[model samples]
Target: MNQEFYHELGHVVLHIGNQRQMTDSFRRYKESKANHFMYHACVPTFMI
Candidate 1:
């Protein structure tokens, strides 16, 4: 599950970097967004 989800997320990241409106859609899917700790932890890397 993690592998598949990670790959899907990778695609999202690619799309975000390539498109503007796509990031809005991606952000919408994230709901409330990552918690503070998770955001901080992933900040240097992904961060939602």
Candidate 2:
């Protein structure tokens, strides 16, 4: 889906090379943030 694509893109934009060095917990945390970024990036405030 588009949302998942953007979420993964978020990781590329913000995390990039840092991901390989992350712990499982931290990776999950960052993934959550990336999802949040995708939601905000794709959704408009008027639609919320």
In model 2, where do residues sit more than 4 Å from their true spots? 18-20, 45-48
Query: Mind giving the per-residue lDDT tens digits that candidate 1 earns over 4-42?
Result: 455455555433444454567666554323232233444
Clashing pairs in 1: none
**Clash count, predicted structure 1:** 0
**TM-score: model 1 vs. ground truth:** 0.30
For model 2, residues 1-48, the per-residue Cα lDDT tens digits are 889899988888877557678799999988898999898888967998
| For every candidate, C-alpha RMSD to the true structure in Å | 10.5, 2.2
Instruction: Please identify model 1 stretches exceeding 4 Å from their true place.
Output: 16-48
Q: TM-scores of the models, in the given order?
A: 0.30, 0.70
